[model samples]
Target chain A: MLGYTITQWLFGILSFLAIMFALMVVFTRNPVNSVLYLVLTFFCIAGHYLLLNAQFLAVVHIVVYAGAIMVLFLFIIMLMNLNADTEPRKHIVTRVIAGVVGGVLLFVVVGALKGAEQLQIVQGGASQIGLVKNLGKVLFSEFLFPFEIASILLLAALVGAIMIGKRDTNINLK
Target chain B: MTAFIIYKAIMCAAVFLLSLGVAAYATLWERKFAAFLQDRKGPSRAGPGGIFQPLADGVKMFMKEEIIPNVSNRSLFIIGPCLFMVTAVMTSVVIPWAKPMMVGGHMYDLQITDINIGTIYLLGVVSIGVYGIMIGGWASNNKFALLGAVRASSQMISYEIAMGIALIALIISSGGSLSLKDIIEGQDKGFANIVWQPLGFLIFFICALAETNRAPFDLPECETELVGGYHTEYSSMKLGLFLFAEYINMFISSAIMAGFYFGGYNFPFSSELYASLGLQEGDWLISLIGFGAYFTKIVLFICLFMWVRWTLPRFRYDQLMNLGWKTLLPLSLFNLALTVVVEYFRGNIHF
Candidate 1:
């Protein structure tokens, strides 16, 4: 009834659910529940990517974020044996400071978006840009340098992680 | 348009029933095969060679006492096996079962959807599959379940990397398209990807085993230690769902392996046979034969899975981790590089 197409309706529903889940992530007291909510939020965002016809990006987003990173988050939360009862309470002053920091961040984000133009949904024959072949061509030809740099950055992080992990083990063994 | 929609609805129902039926029989077959290996006859009393055994098992699972632990997270406990079964069934959507069938001047695809990113979609769904185990285990509030959940997640994650890398090499060789249809078509015209990509196939097979939580990597639900593992607290139909989902996953993975490595629905000299038999393209009989070929490959792979399950002992947890990280990861990486080099030399890919 809003004069929206099916895709547009889907977009609105996904966006609404995304924000709801994102809010739940912050509101949930249990760390595991928080992580799961965040995962739901990520899935909603990925749904938006799919609606935008970015199939590769949508699947990769779920694989990398919702699948891999959130699993690690769950692992840490589960392994640490943290529960609402075991969760340490912050002092009143500390809570106040954290709230102030979060508010400021939100304010900054809203301020930055205040002057942005409204985005138009591109409708027609499905966009080719999101398909794997075209995306690969664009990535390798135009974005090659930036992509390589990103890979190098990731390699550095990997090396740093291994070194840190090995150092402690070495000390313990010695 | 209505006809097309009706066709798709029928196709979906068929695939759903097919997966459920295969899973049911797989359980019986697993028992029969295990019996053969151990020098005993498996369940022969029910309807000749235990043909109705799966039905009996279904009834048993349905009739068992439903129990939810008092301390367990009620909602999540209910959600666990349901999620597992849902994800298990969801993966078959993109798989092309057989060649398209022509009806009333239209060629209907046997697959539910042929998305271009089919490979990654499989990986994504499989990665999400771990959540079912994780949530189920965590909701149980039992230490054993928690440990099993942790192992399942870690093991699946580790093996997934190798699996994706191994698939990358295969994709590079078998046309760069990510669609399963394209990969299968590539094989239909030429040799199956298995000839050149044996090592890649082996790596993928191993990773699939670990990902599906089959034996040798079935540490997540190993009975000796964890006493049912992630499904320890699950009872009756809930436990049945978890067990049923594993067989479904096995069937799907076997179909995928058949599609990826073996010529999916394309036996050797199939076109020659078709031409000699004077069969036209899109003929129902041809499609049926192609489907028979596909089914044979899947059955063979399932047998191999069952054979290994009965043959090999379960890997120690440390050894499983070591093999996934230290061995298969590097081996798959090597396969990727090797495929790239060979493809480049073959003039199939430009630098």
Candidate 2:
């Protein structure tokens, strides 16, 4: 049998990639670069989704987060015409403090995960129940209210985007 | 055990190399296809119907003088295309090229990885892909690039809803499994889900086109108006990477559509075909042949993408938004409702 060591190694590499990219996203000086790095970070997170047996969630994460939202972020960054010089420079002390805070947060999260050793990691591989059909049934039945609310939230966001994006002259006419 | 490890390693390398090679040649194929449609000879001089064209193009891109625009954000400019290409290539991991094979007393699926959430993983990767264009355009510090990025982002976001809704309809019909393998297996019984979910297929196809930023939906890099759109300030291999990612995306998108709706590696009368060929059940060779069939379908879809690119005109920004929100979105929602009603009446509703 192929040993679990290979899988563990693969997971280790992917997790490291994800964490590094996430850090890069914040640390990058250019906002546009930061956005790109964030996209990388999201892709790595999707990799973790694959490792977790959540294929549908992984694809949806890419579609929604990387494909759609990141585009919006990029659009905003570009529209703002931000440059390296335009970006506010943080003082060295501020940067150090931020780094320390981030390090502490990371340590806490890792420590919590380690402390939960008795917690079983469910091997929820693809089954008949996890299909889109099952998900839809749950969404439309047990979670219908929340699903509807989410739709409403999306609608509100859409309308707000339209209103905010409208030309000043058009708004004045209204 | 060492042999098995070696074989798996070789397979991984092969798939990775093959994808990159195919992505390179896809550019050549697109050019040739576009030229054929336009009634012109496409790159005939670059070695026997332009087989060496991709290599030549690669060399040219590599050798080109790299330019960093004076006012541009250098770091982001570099990051954009790298992010784009990485996301484009990463989507292939979960794709089942063939059924699992027994080698050295171990059964292994031909896919690189068999993640349960394979389809959603693809969507997530694609969503992140937009950042490449956005960041590239933003870093350029050009008004035109900024405009292009804005148009692209909004367009992608609007169309994504329609796409998601269509997929939801398919999921309801298919009984909730998001793994591509399971989705393929679900269709193995008889008719493909596309037969039952025709409207859903249509909605998904159109959205797929929009998602890939193909012709009519390719407002992000609309050359005539936005001066090459998001990549206007890009130069050298960095620009080439962005363009390369687009084509790879096209290939990947087509592969996905084929997998989800076209029955993947399963062909009509495939079982009979296997029997006629004297292939035993679970034969690795037969499965590989099935993989070839699936790939052929994917290639056809890719060709269709190029065909559409040559056929259609770019959509106006307002028209694009309208199509996404007013038309495709409503149509997909209607289709979803229809699917639910039909499935409920048929007693196919598992819940």
Candidate 3:
């Protein structure tokens, strides 16, 4: 029970941390700083996943998002020479439009929250569904089609990416 | 409860101190190893057989002045080395050092925690390890540092996939458990994993060499190209820390390789040794003996690491990338497929 209480406290602290880092990801002016903040946010979310007894999900999230993707983000930001404090200023009209879009999104989110359903808390062994064996079984059996489709979509995206990333060299005229 | 807590604390201190101590000596060993390879005298003035060279090196590092460049981000410059050292230290946790020992009739494990998903945890932390170099190099704001950082990040990212895939093959071959203790114990029961997963071991070893930034794969900090690489702007103990973390990383990686492929603390004649002595397995006596064998294996690995370092020249960056992505990655996947096919043929694999 003491350990359980500590876990709850940790979850609360980590949720707050995740939100703060998420905000920092947007607010940071430096692209590298923003990417680092985003990585911190990913780690905080990984902590939340761990708190939910989803160890595999937490680790995979770290490995893929924080580890690989954010490192690439840092790499790209560095290679493009984007670290200088030289962000172009937005036009007044553009800022106003962005503000309006943000306001609308916030309102929509709040309105949806007004009709939120009651929380369904399952008893013992519910969290065990996050274990690798159980998760894999569910993915293969119940969610097989969706899983296959998602992978196929990812494969198509990968191929499209290669095509996009390829340099267009002009051929010599014979 | 107090005893358990005390034991855990002691184990933590022991593992930490052991890693630092071994890292210190590994530096001396590396020097001596290089000298032996090159047929020259190496640090004979420090102590007998250069045994005290690490201590002298430590003192020298401490005495050096700490420097912060005017353009460098001060806070991040400091955090970079500290983060690198912390990640390097943390990786030793999942490795089971020896068999469980008996203390006052309570069985005490030499390992910190035998958690499930240990290898995944290692992968995750290792992925995060790139941040230290990235932050340090970026904070330096120097072109060489930046290039080095970029190289380090890309190199780690490329190698980690192959490393993880190779590990997955091992996991499949070793009954699909993600725990190191299970892997090692299973290995101890039979021959080492090198028997079944030789190709996997080779792939893992190469990836490990790349991962630890050892020679041939030392492109990130190659002196000729990048001028000390990511630590170009770093000075004093901060520099010491980055260097320390590398050696510490080498030690941990070697230890892990031993555990996963070399039967951990188990020797081939360990059971026979026990039988001759009329002692049971899993006893503290056996545990101590196993620890002795484990230490020997670790020393041999450290030697191997140093030997390879002195023997091979550093790889060019593009060549490193090609080896990682084209060669090792596919080879690991093929090994995984071969494992699956064999397991299916052996009638152990199920859908």
Candidate 4:
């Protein structure tokens, strides 16, 4: 019981930290600072995954979001080299509306979670069975078609990203 | 009982302190190694053989004035090194230092944590390590730093795909087990996985070296071009952290390489040797011996890392990109195909 409470306390603190960092990511005016905070936010999410016994997911989360995606965002921000002077200021009314919408979204999420009372909560050990090996088996066997489709989607996204990033050139259109 | 927890805590503390101490000394070693390579004696006045050089260097770094440029992003500049150190150290948790032992009617493993997805977790954590360099370079507010960060990020991304594909080949060859423990166990009985997947091992080793930003792929910190690369603006302990984190990462990657490809703590005829020694099942001493074997392997890999650093030359940026994308990627794919075919012929395909 004591162990459970300790784990819960840690989880709560981590979650709070994650949410705070995420808010900071949005609120920060500096794009570079915002991306850094987003990395922190992703770290907090990874912590949550750890708490949930999804070690693989936690690591993947860090690798993809904090490592790759955030680095790319930093690259774009640096490439543009926009400073505070170049940033457009948000009006007071717009800020207030944004705050209100953020609040409503948070409330709705919390309310929906609260309403899901009948969900069966499995303990850590029981859920540990579906670890990397089992997950791979399911991913390859049961969801092979969907997984292939997902790969195709990722390829499309990659091509799209490259196309958008390419410089405009004086060439004949197809 | 409580003593076991204390023992574990002490062990963890020892490994942490030892790694840091080693990282500090690695600077001195690098200097000496480089000097020797150039046919000159390195610093020898600090202490006997300049053994105290790292201490002197540490003090000097701490005393140095930390210059924060007015235009620099001060907060991120501060946070960057801290992030690097944290990510570097975190990957050590899942590494099994030794085998499990029976203590007080319960089994205890020598690792801090033994998650089922140990290898993937490592992959994931290493992937995030690039952010530390990116953040530092960007926060410096210098053109050189920016260029370094851009190069570092793209290089990391390009190399990561090949690294992941190499790992996929290993995973396929190993019958889809992602747990480092299982992989090590599978490689027991004097039949290491490297024998089966030599190409995969080679690919993974090269990628590992590149991932840790060691020499030959140390373009991010290349002095000739980018003037200390991403860390040009850093000073004092912040700079120390970045440098120290690199060594720490080197050590971790070496340990990981040993664990995955070198059969970890297992040795040929280990079971027979244990039997001859009259070591019964659940013997803590046997586990200790096993752990020692693993530690020795890790140390050897570290020495190899240092040797390679001294021997290799840095790769050109275009060459690095081409090697990662054109060469390593296609090779890994071919290896993956080979693994699949072998498994299929053996009637051992999991599907």
Candidate 5:
């Protein structure tokens, strides 16, 4: 047997699960099922974050992706009443394009992994970086500019959403 | 390591049993409390003052017939209630029941696990809780159930934003530690968070009501409109699980409110009493007294929940959404700013 601590074994299992569920998200015929599978994939990713001792990241991942975003996706699908019977079939040309796009994405990922291998892998030591206090200090001090920029970007997106959602007063008056 | 694992296992079992037991009694109490409000006796036949009512109810639920619609998705349909119950039980793990107790030479925390991001963990678990109602309602393949599920998910999502903001305000005033233990200790040293963050507490309280699907905000299971709502197609223990999870959620949220705002497990004159008794810190007896105080606070909160449930009428769906987004959200933001201002002036927080 290969030498592996419980943590390593758990990491391997979670990685496998993440990939499997990601595949399930694509393969599932029903839209609701697809969304639920994606949620499982998110949970697996969150598990990976926990294994890294990024406790804040892990919980936030669950809260945002698995909890909020996926629920919205499921909500939309449920509202639409989409099912396997109602799923529109793709043309052969469209399927071919999708396949090609997926292949290119996989290639890019593999290339990234190859590059990542050259970088030093910090393994097997508990780091305080994941704790909220350290994370807040880092974000506030060193990464202050990027963090504020991100907040501004989010505010802009919020304004855009509200504008899109608003009705035309002129049309309503008429 | 072995001893630690064994201790943790025991803690898990204890917490699991405690939640379930509390949830069971909560059901009986809800009925009896409702009876008290309406000026009638409730379930008096089971035992003296209906003490065995929950037990009887449990037996009835277990003995009843369970049905799964032929058209429904079997797996998701079955998984729904189990998921609901699991998440309900999972929340109690992070709650510090009392001060750490000294047993033999070791200090053992009453909490199951004291993760650093305890508050966010609760939020995450609560956010995931909507899935149980959603899946159950959808998997029923019935129109009423589907409508219920839709209402549930939307309501939970809307209220959660305000709830998180309210929590952020409280966390700011209570020294920015996400751990419940630290929050409680901060209260022990000074005033409970409620004194400082009353607005935040009110917002959090309202949001908790909405989050738990308690009445006045229980649109998800509104019977007059959508007959039986989310559990329309459920039968026997499957339905029981959904109801049970609701009570457990109420209990856990009560405990959280106690910890976050009400100085959990800390009573006035506690130190003086301990000193007079010749008991040192971390004494088991001291922890037990603190637990009794904490339990009293939680029970009071639970009764308050019941009181509101009986008194107030449910809001219209539009009204609920408007209150959550238009009212609570802005109020929570204002509270956050107010808390920040106060903390800075007090020199507790540095810009």
Candidate 6:
């Protein structure tokens, strides 16, 4: 029954790809390659959102993460001229410790998720509720204050970053 | 169900091929239009008034030697143009090309798919188009190409803000729905949205020009300065792909502009004429006229693109940035506020 529907198939494939890309994002030696892998992971998650019928979230996730944020990351990585040759190899003990810690983290996550298969997932979660009109109504009516606060927080962060980055160097001689 | 799927498959193929053909012919038209503006004959030797020029040009692109620089990243260099072409083609998916077609007592929607978040999908696809230029420029490992890529991504990213804001005003006017079909139908019930969204249209047109990298905002690939810009190192079909993608973008942008602002195929007097002819809706005759009307809108906008290209000088890069950030951004925000206030007064908004 779980394998019969297209949605279940898509979720399986996308989740597999997402996890694979997430691993690749960390394991890739080249920063640009890592960024590209992260982009793929973002796209996979966006596909999962679309599978859940959250089209708005899917598009916004792509627009914000893959389109903008990852592009910025790639820009910085490219500007820094990073490549395999430039990468500093980590110490063997450090790598071993990281492997152990990562293994433990995976174990805990897998343990936590072991029972998830037993839980019944809805085939569709009220598609109309996920549409833009109802979402907008819900956001504005119930979550209006939180949305406004989030905007103000982002605005403050943007201004602070600008202020921190701006310099007043006036000592150039031609 | 299979028939329905087959119909959609046909519509997809038709839209894809239509975009490709339109982009090819648009190149020929651009040259011819330029000739008209400058009082010269342009490529008449190929066919009647150079009608076969695009075909000839395409053959040449295929026949030319494909060159990849030794220093360049080989796979990415190959992938760049392909991605550019793919993104260019993808934007057309959200644009509804025609009204429903009736065949064998079944109504088949003439569009490929009418996704709910059509405008957002379009904007997302367009925003990602920057990657094609960025990767192409970067993979070339050429300084000029890298600079061109940087300029492309920055320009597209900046202009997209204004473009999004301008479209927000349209969305407000359309009463918060992002479906292009609904918006076009809404305009059909009234005057074309251009009447009410004139400022939005102005900002939108300017931003569209910027987004497509057309003059006077064509700094990304401006030939004189960058020597072919991002595609400087590319040759043969790769270069053709890069260049062809621009015309495709132009065609799609025109279709978008027509769909959003000019009421798409909702030509003024067509319905009256159809009523006078005693033909019901979804008749083949009406569909033909409506299809012609939609293409007319697209062709007119395409001509406007050519007109501006031939007329206006390219802007300096700084001037381009300044216009995008200082002028268009603030103007679009003002348009947004104005629209909100007006809609409030018109009682289109509750609370």
lDDT score for residue A139 of model 5: 99
Greater DockQ among 2 and 4 belongs to 4
Q: Calculate DockQ per candidate and list them.
A: 0.84, 0.52, 0.82, 0.70, 0.89, 0.81
**lDDT string, candidate 6, A75-161, tens digits:** 888778788888898999999999999999999999999989999877664566777888899999999999999999999999987
Which model scores highest in lDDT?
A: 1
Query: TM-scores, in order shown?
Result: 0.96, 0.80, 0.94, 0.87, 0.96, 0.96
Worst ten in a row by lDDT for model 6 chain B: B219-228
What lDDT tens digits, residue by residue, belong to model 5 across residues A66-131?
888889888888888999999899999999999999999999999878867678888624987987
Candidates in descending lDDT order? 1, 5, 6, 3, 4, 2
Give the lDDT of residue B326 in candidate 6: 92
Give me candidate 3's TM-score against the actual structure.
0.94
Error of 5 at B69 (Å): 1.3
Model 5 chain B: lowest-lDDT 10 consecutive positions: B219-228
lDDT of 6 by residue, B117-136 (tens): 99999999988898889889
True contacts kept of each: 0.80, 0.96, 0.88, 0.96, 0.92, 0.72
Instruction: Enumerate residue pairs that collide in model 5.
Output: none
Give the Cα-based TM-score of candidate 5 against the true structure: 0.96
1 or 2, greater by DockQ: 1
Error of 3 at A117 (Å): 6.3
For B1-351, candidate 4 gives per-residue lDDT tens digits of 788778679768867886787677767887887888889899898999999999998899899998887988888888878988998998887787777778788877767766777777787878777778888888898988878877876887888888888888787777677777788878776577787789998998888888888878998777877576888888888988888898899888888888888888887788998999999867988887887788788778877777788898889988998999889999999998998898788676844
Model 6 complex DockQ against the native = 0.81
Model 2 DockQ class:
medium
By the lDDT metric, which is better: model 3 or model 5?
Answer: 5
Q: Which stretches of candidate 5 lie over 4 Å from their true place?
A: A92-97, A104-116, A168-174
Model 5 DockQ class: high
| Residue B44 of model 1, lDDT score | 96
The DockQ of predicted model 3 stands at 0.82
